[model samples]
Target chain A: MKVRVEVMLKDGVLDPQGEAVRHALGTMGFAGVESVRQGKLIEMDVAEGTTDAEVKAMCERLLANTVIESYRIEM
Target chain B: MKVRVEVMLKDGVLDPQGEAVRHALGTMGFAGVESVRQGKLIEMDVAEGTTDAEVKAMCERLLANTVIESYRIEM
Candidate 1:
């Protein structure tokens, strides 16, 4: 099975990297870039029998920092 | 308008970060992880009239390293 995990910073969290990109865009003359938030996309190939629970466990254990980020799983 | 840019290393390109994550998962006892690829997701809030061409330009010029990475834009 193929699973995709998107891990993003929770609302209200500061994202320096995103800010940097936004600043760079402004300097490059791409105006009207109101906001930017950067996140991670992890695509995994797992054994056929791997359950969604196991994938969620992986996210909880290592893929995402639960305190500051939230993850969405797509199968 | 909201735009999402997904930047991923092209196939045949080595992804050291993904390899490290796989190794870590193995150490953490999550078996059956056949393969893993890590990528970037950048979300942007841009002006209502921003054109797709402009966004593509952003990806080509700065958001993605076209030599080794490919990017997808979603609006």
Candidate 2:
């Protein structure tokens, strides 16, 4: 079974990388690019029968940085 | 309008950061964590009337690394 996990910086967290990209975009004349934030995505082929709850638990338990990020899963 | 963009490494791309995390998880006794890949997410509060097509254009034109990653948008 294929699964996708997305981890993104929580609101109110500082993202220097994102800011850099935003500035670069502005420099390159990209209008309306107000901000940017970077995060992570993980895709894996888990064993068959892996439950969504279990995958979510994996995210909450290890895959994400909860202090600075939140996660979503697609199964 | 609020939008989310998710950028993830394309399949078969080597992900050193993910490998590192997987190793760490193993060391910390996390079972069943077969693999990991790192990516990025960007969220923006665009002006009202921003269309999904425009948001997608932003992603393809700048926000994502299209060569090694793909993006999805949420409005």
Candidate 3:
């Protein structure tokens, strides 16, 4: 099965890379780009019949920084 | 309007970061993890009723590299 995971910095966390992208956009003449938040997408082809519990556990253990990042898993 | 853009490298492109993460996961004891592809998510709050053309323009101009990356936009 194919699982998709999105991990993003929690609200109030500083995102320097996102800020840099926004600045770059402004400089590149793409105006009115008010706010931008960046995240990561991890696509994995896990074994078939892998339980959601297992996927969630993988996310909690290895996929995300639970302290300052939150993750959503899609099967 | 709130828009989401996902940008990923084209197939056949080398992703060293993803490979590094995969190796790290292996060292951390997460077995049976097959292929992993990493991408970026850009979430932005744009002007109300921004046209799809405008969004596509943004993607082509600033959000992604057309030569090596593909992007999908969602509103």
Best by lDDT: 1
Interface RMSD of 1: 0.5
Which regions of candidate 1 deviate over 4 angstroms? Answer: none
Model 2: lDDT to the true structure: 0.77
Question: What is the C-alpha lDDT profile of model 2 across A1-75, one tens digit per residue?
Answer: 678887888889998887887787677665676777777777766667878887877788788978788998988
Q: DockQ of each candidate's interface versus the true one?
A: 0.94, 0.49, 0.75
Give the per-residue lDDT of model 3 (tens digit) for A8-73.
999999988888887887887767778889999988877787788888887898889999999999
Measured with C-alpha atoms, the lDDT of residue A39 in candidate 1 is 99
Candidates sorted on TM-score, descending: 1, 3, 2
The candidates, ranked best first by DockQ, are 1, 3, 2
Lowest lDDT sum, 10 consecutive residues, model 1 chain A, at: A43-52
Model 2, docking class: acceptable
Clashing pairs for model 3 are none
Clashes of 3: 0
Q: Tell me what TM-score chain A of model 2 achieves.
A: 0.88
Alpha carbon lDDT of residue A8, candidate 1? 97
RMSD per candidate (Å) reads 0.5, 3.0, 1.5
Clashes of each: 0, 0, 0
Residues B1-75 of candidate 1 have per-residue lDDT tens digits of 999999999999999999999999999999999889999999999999999999999999999999999999999
